[model samples]
Target chain A: MPSTEYRPPRPFSRIYVEDAARDHPETARVLRRFSRSRTVPISHYKDIFNRPRQEWRAQKESPALILAARHGEFLYDASAYTPTFGHKRFHYNALALNCVYDCAYCYLQGMFPSAHIVLFVNIEDYFAATEAALAEGPLYLALSYDTDLPALEHIIPYTRRWIEFTRTRPGLTVEIRTKSASFNRFADITPTDNAVLAWTLSPASVAARYEAKTPPPAQRLRAAAKALEAGWRVRLCIDPVLRVPGWENAYTALVDEIAEALDAGKLEDVSLGVFRINRDYLKHMKRRAAPTDVLYHPYEKRSALATYTAEEHKSMTSLLRSCFARHIPADRIHIV
Target chain B: MIILHTALAAEARPLIRRLGLKPGPGAPAPRLMVGDGTALVVSGTGRVRAAAAVAAAWTRLDATGHAPSAILNTGLCGAADSGRHPRGSVFVINACTDTTCGRRYYPDILLRHSLPEAGLHTFDKVIHSPEEARSGVRTAPELVDMEAAGVFEAGTLFLPASHVHALKIVGDALTDARFVTAADVESLIDDAIESITAFAAALRAFAASSEKSGRVLDESEERALGEAMDALRLTATQRARLSAAARHYRLLHDAPPSPVLAAFAARPPKSKNERAQALDRLLHALNGV
Candidate 1:
C-alpha cells in the first residue's frame, strides 16, 4: 500500500475578478476577506473557467476564485439526477460553479472543464429571477446544486444570504444541501420555515476514502442536531450511496448512528439514492480523474445515464430503506 | 517533458550549463539545447521571435512523440519600483497582458513557490522610463517584459494555461534605456536559476502525476489488447466495445483482460455470427459474469 501522508488543503492564492464586477459589494467583500491573495482581472469568468485542455486534477489541487457578474441565465430546471422531493415546480441555480470539496464521484468534474470556483457576484439578479419564477406558482428551488454553499460560508456567506432571501418568500422553498458541518455560520439568525438545511451523510469509511476535504459524518450529525434543536427544518441525505465492499454494514451503522445522535421523529425526511451519473459525464470523469473503484464499476448504460444494473440498484436501495425505516417512518423516506 | 524558452542566448546559457543541457543535432534555427526530457530555445529579443521559436521547438519535440508537458518562458524584465522589486529578484507571473491588443492572459499558478508573485505586461517596444511604463501599461504590472504574452499565447495553443508559465528576473529599473549588458542579464537569470528549475520540476511532476492517474492502460496492456483485436478480426464497432471492456476490466482488476482472448487460439471465429457470439462471451467474462 502507498504510504498515506497528510497534506494540507491548497489555499486560494489567486482571485480572478471580472472588470464589470470589481465594484460589486460581494466582490469587495471577498477581496477584503482574501486580502493577501493575488487579484487578477479578466473580462469574463469563462475565459479562465471554461478554457479547454485545463487539467481538472491540477486545478482541483489549488483552485482559484473567479468572481464574475452573471449576465445571462440564473435559474435552470433541475436535472434528472437531482430529486425534486415531489415538488411539481423544481428549479436550481448556478450562483456558484464548481465546488470547494472534491468528492471522487462528483459529476462536476465532468460537467465543468476547470475546478476553479466561479462565483456569480450579481446575486440580486438570481433573486429577481427566482422571484419571477415564484410568480408562476409554488417553487421548490435547490440552491446548492452545483456547489456546497455552507462549505463556502467562510469565504462568502451565500448560504446565510440565501436563507435570508427565502425567509420572506412564502411560496418559495429552497434546499441548501451540503456535506459541511458549518451550521455555526448562521447560528445567530432565526431559522426559516421554508428553508431546508439538508446534510448528505456518508459512512465514515466511505467519507475517509472517497469524499476528500468534506467533514466527516459525526461532525455533520452534530451540526444537524444543532439545527434540529434550533427548530431548523433539517433533512438527512444518504445520497449516491456507493456499492462498496461492505456497503450494507456501513449504511446500517450510519443509520444507527443517525438515530442515536438525533431524534428521527423531528427530522424533516431522509433522501436515499444509488450512485448514478450521466454516461458521457462518467466517460469524461474516467478520462480525467484518478482511478478509483467507484468510477471503474461496470455500470449499466441506458441512453445517456450510467448506473448499476436494475437488480443491483434495487438491492442497494432496499437495504438502506429497510435499515433507515427502523428509525424514520417509511412515508418520510425518499429514494431518487 | 518540459520546454524552456529564453529571449537571448545569454539568458539560456546559465540554465543550459546548470541543467546539463547539450546542443541538438547539427543546428536548429533560434538555437535548441536539450537535456533529459527538457529543451531550451534561445529566441532573439522580440515577441514575434519568441512566439515563433516556441512553436518551432514544440513542433520538433512533438514530432518525436515526446511532446512537452510543461512550458516555462523565463528571462530578464524591468520593474518600475526598483526598491520594492530590486534587480536579480525573481517573480512567478500570475498574469500577463499584451499592450498592443489590450488582451490579457492569466496562467494558472497552481504550484507552491517562495518567490513573490507579480503580474507582467508584455510590451511591443521597450520602456525607457517610468513615465512610459505608467502611460502604456494599464494593469499596473510590477514587471515589464517583451515575450510573456507571446510565449503564453503560443504555449497555450498546445498545452493548458496551467502547464504554461513565465518567470521574470528583474534586470533593471525602468529608468535605463540601454545600460544593461549581456553579462548583467546572464547574472540576473543565474541568480534565480534555482527557483526557475524548482518551479519547472514541480510542474513536470504535477503533469506526470496527472498523466499517470488518467492512464487507463499501460503500454504493454495496450499492445496485448491491440494484438487480440487483430487476432479476433472484429468489426469496428466490436473493436471499440472490446477495447472499452478491456479498459474497464483493467481498471477494476489492475491487470489486462487480454489473457481471456487466448480461448479463441485453437478455433478462431469463422463468420460474423461466430465473431459476435465470441465477442459477447468475451465481454461478459471481462464484465465479471
Candidate 2:
C-alpha cells in the first residue's frame, strides 16, 4: 500500500557563509532567496562542512546550505572511471559540491563527508579559470560534475550563464548532465550547438527503486523531448544500468518507451554503461546505505574502481547495447 | 542513553525536577541523577571539575554496560549583551573555546533544535564587569560560560562529537551582573525548561535515527571478524575488501555466515598470499567476479 502521509519540503534551515563570500553580490543574491534561514559565518567552508564525526546519513535527511568563495583551481581532468566521450581535452568543473537529488548509487555519497550542498557563489572566478584553460587548447568541460546544476536553476542560474558564456567562446564544448525535469528554463534562449543538455535516463523500475526524489523517468523523457524541440543538442545517458530483478524486461520496456516518446534521430548521442563506483566511495556508501540492494553488489575492484564481475558487466552492457541498436544507429551509441 | 552535565545544583535543579529524576547511587564523588533513559550529573564550577565530572559519569555508565547515546551540557551563562538576548533566553552552543587552554571544540549541529545557536567562550573566571564582557565580545563569542569546552572535550572521548550538545540560558548580561541574584540563576533556567526538554527529546530522536542508519555490524561481530581475519594473516587492503564483501552479502541476503566465507573460515589460509587468494575466490563466488 502506498503511504499517504504528508511530507513538508525539507528546505535548509541554516546557511553557513564564508567570511570572504559574506559581501559577494552572488552571496547577497542567494541569501535574498533564503532570507528566512539563519546565517552563520565561518572562516572557510571546510570548517563547518569538513568537520570530523559528521553524521552523513542524518544530515542527508535534511541537508543545510553553505555559500563560499572557491579559491585556487576550479577545473580538473576527468577521473579515469568517467568516460570522456572521445573528447581529447575532457575536463570537469565543480562550481558546486554535492548534488540536490539523492540517488542510492550516486558516488557523491562517498566522495563527500557531509550531504549539505555547497554552492561556490563565484561564477566569474570559474569562468575566468575556464577561459585561461581554454586559451591553451580546445576544452570539453562538463559543468555539472559534482552537482545537478539545472536542478537548481530556480536558485542559481549557472546553467544559463554557462550557455551564455559558451556562445562567445569558440572551440568550447560544454555538457550539462542532469536528471531534473525542469527543461522549461531553456525555452526562451536559443540553443547552441556547442552546448549539450544531457538527460540521464533509467528504467522506470530502477529509478523508482534507487533514484529517490528525482523526476520520474517518463517526465525526464518528456523534458528531453522538449529540449530537442527547442533545437538543443540533447544526449541520452543510460549509464549506471542497475541489474534489478526482471531488469531485462524493465530495460526493454524503457527502450520502447524512449522510442515512442523521443525522436531518436535528433539525439546527439547515446551513452551506455553499467553500475560502477570508486572502490573507496563504495566503502563509504556501504556503511550508510547498507539496506540498498544496488550498493550491496559484490563488486570486483580493478585499479581503484569497483564494478560487477567481468561476466556481469559484459552481460549487462551487451544486453543494453543490443537494446539500443534496435532503435538508434549502432555508430551513434557510445559504450563506456 | 542521554547524559546531561551541569556545573551547579541550581543549574540542574529545574531539569531534575522537570524530568523527574532521583538521586543516582553510582559515582559518589559527583552528584548524579537518573530517570528514564537519561542521567544528569552536577559538576562543580570550573573546567577541571567539569571534565572530571564528565569522566566519572561516563565511567559509571560504562560500568553499567550502557554507553551514552548522547551527552549534553545545560547550564546558565553570562551573555555579552542584554539588549541582544535578555536573561532567560536559551542558546545552543555550536562552538566552544577554552580561554585557558586556547583550544576550540565544535559540537555537531546535525539535528535541528528549537533554540537559536551561538558560539561560546569558556573562561576560568566569570565575566562580571561590562568591560570584560565587551572584551569577550571582541573574541566573537555571543555567550560566556565556564564549562562548555571541558564538557565537550570530555564527552567526545566516549561519544562521537556529533552526539555532544551544549545549551546555555542567559543568567545575566555583564551590564546586569550587579543586579542579578542567585534566585535569578534558578529562575532563568526554570523559565527555559520547556525549550530544554524539547531539545533533549530532539537529541534522543536524532540518536535513535542515527543508530538505525548506522547499521554497521555490532561491536562483537566486528571484533570477531577482525580477529578471524588477523588469524588468516591478510593484508590491510584484503581485510577491508573482505569486510566490505561480507557486509554486502549480509545486506543483500539478510543472512549471516555466507557459504563462501564459511568455507574460507573453516580452513584458515596458511600464508598471506593464500589469504589474499582465498579472499579473491570468495568475492568472486559471492559477487560473480
Candidate 3:
C-alpha cells in the first residue's frame, strides 16, 4: 500500500542555468531566490535534464530546477482530444516543462522523460510568439498547459505578467488552469474578462488519494470563489473523473459542496471529463505508478486514447451533468 | 542484492568481516564472497581488473537470476593534501575522471550519507612524488584512486548511475603514498566500517524503494486480463489497455467477479469499440461505481 504520511516539499539542492539564459534578468532573479543551492552552468538545459538513466519516480521526490531560454516554437494548437470549450481557435503554450504537483494520473508522467521542472526564463519570447499569432487573428490560449504556472506564481510570477499582458491585448483570450490554492496573488490586480482562471476540482477523497501535494477540493473551491468575487471569469473543471469505489456518492457530495460555496451564475462554465489518458502515456504511468488504484483501472483504448468504457463515460458524465444541472444551467456545462 | 567491489583483498577484508560474508566455494574469478542478500568481489588492482571484476560479478549474479539492486565501490585513495582531509577520512566520490582516457563519469548523489564527498581522479599509476601529485592537483581532484572510474563505467552497464556509488577512504597523502603498506589500507577501511555499513544499509533501502516503484502486474491478474482480451480478439493496443483497466479494477476492488468474466466469455466483443466499451463496463462493475 502507498503511504499516506505527508512528505514535505523537497527543496532544489541544485539549479542548472543555461548559458543563453544565464545573463537574463529573470534568471538572475530566480537564482537569487535559491542562493543556497549549488548552481551548475550548462550549454543547454537538456544536458542534465535529458541525460540517460534518470529515474523519473525517484527524481520527483526532490526535483532540480532548470532555467533555460526557449528559442524555437513556443505555442501549438491544442490536441484533438483536449476540449476547446466551443472556441474556434484553441492553442496552448509551454512556458515551463514539468509540474511541481505529483498527481498520480497526470499525463506528464509519460509526456516528460524527467520530473525536474524547466522554467523557460525568457517569457518575452512566449509573449512575442503569442502576439505574432494574434496579429493574424483572434486567439484562445491556455497559458498553463505543460506546467502549473499559478502554483509557481511566487517563483516565476508568469501568471501575473500574463494577466497584465492580456489587459492590453484585445484579441487574445488567456486561460490559466491550475489546482493550486495560491489565489492571493490576484488580490491587488484588476481582474480581466479575457483572462479565465480555470480551477481543476476533484472530490475531496479523490484529491486526497491521488492528487499528491495539490490543495484539497474545498481549498480549490474557495480559491475559485475568490476568483469569481474578484471579477475574473472562472471555469470549474471536474475532469479526468476516476471510477473509484463509491464514486457516485463521492461526486454527488462534491457537486453539492461546490454549489453551496460559489455563486453558480458567476461561473464561466464547468468542463466535465471522465478519467482518460493517452494510450502511450497510460502504459508508461502504469509501470511507474503501479501502486496507485486510479492508474491501474481497466480502460478502453481507441485511436491511441485510453479511457473508461463508452458506456461508463456516458453514465458518469450524464450523472455529473445532472448533478451540476440542479445548480447551474445545462448549457453552461461542456462534456469531453 | 548489493554488490561491493574493492581493488584489493585488504580493502574487502574489513567489509567481509563486518558483513559476515563467507567465500563462496568454486566461485569464478574476482573471488565472490556471499552473505545475506549481499556479495563482495576483490577486483585486485588497476582500472582494467576493476572493470573486469565488476562485469564478472554482474554476469554471475544475472545467471543466478539475481541482478544487483545497487553496486558500491569502496577502497583506499591518496588524498590531495593530508592536512586538509586527514588519513582514514571517508569521502563519497561524486565525480570520477579517468586520466588515461580523459573520460569523466558522475555518480548520482541521491542518498544522504554521513561521509563528506569529493571529486576523484582514477590514475593508472600511483602518484608517488610531490610533483606528480601537483600535476594531479592541477586537474582539481580532491581524491586520487585506481579503480573508481572503471567501477563506475562497469556499474552503469548493468545498473543506473543512481544505483552506483563510490566511497574512498584516504589511505595516504601524496607525500606518504610510497610509504603506505597493505596493513595501513586494511586499518583505514577497518576504522570506517561503522559508517560504511550504515551507507550500505542506506543504499539497500534506496534500491528497495526504486524496485517497489516499478512493480509488475501480479501473475493471476495478468492471466485473467490476458484471458479476457483473448476472448474479445482485441488489437494489440486494446489488449494492453484492457489489461491496464483490469489491473486498475483489481487495485480498487478486492476481486474480479466470476460472473463478469463468464458474461464476457459468453458474448465476446466483436469490434474494437465494442471491446473497449465492454472492458470499461467490466471495470466500473468491478469498482461498483
C-alpha RMSD of candidate 2 = 4.8
Interface RMSD of 2: 7.4
The C-alpha stretches of model 1 lying farther than 4 A from their native spots are A1-9, A135-137, A246-253, A325-329, B227-231, B250-278
> Which has the greatest TM-score?
1
Q: TM-scores of the models, in the given order?
A: 0.90, 0.87, 0.82
Candidate 1 local distance difference test against the native: 0.85
Task: Determine the C-alpha RMSD for candidate 1 after optimal superposition of all C-alphas.
Answer: 3.6
Docking quality level of the chain pair in candidate 2: acceptable
Q: Interface RMSDs of all predictions? A: 6.3, 7.4, 6.8
A89-178 per-residue lDDT for model 2 (tens digits) = 999999889887889899988888888889999899999999999899999999998999998888788999999999989989999999
- Global CA lDDT computed for model 2: 0.81
* Candidate 2 error regions (>4 Å): A1-9, B23-27, B97-106, B136-139, B216-289
Q: Which is better, 1 or 2, measured by TM-score?
A: 1
Candidate 1 C-alpha lDDT tens digits along B197-227: 8777777776676667577878877877777
Task: Identify the candidate with maximal DockQ.
Answer: 1
A220-283 per-residue lDDT for model 3 (tens digits): 8999999898888999999888888788999999999999999977799999998788989877
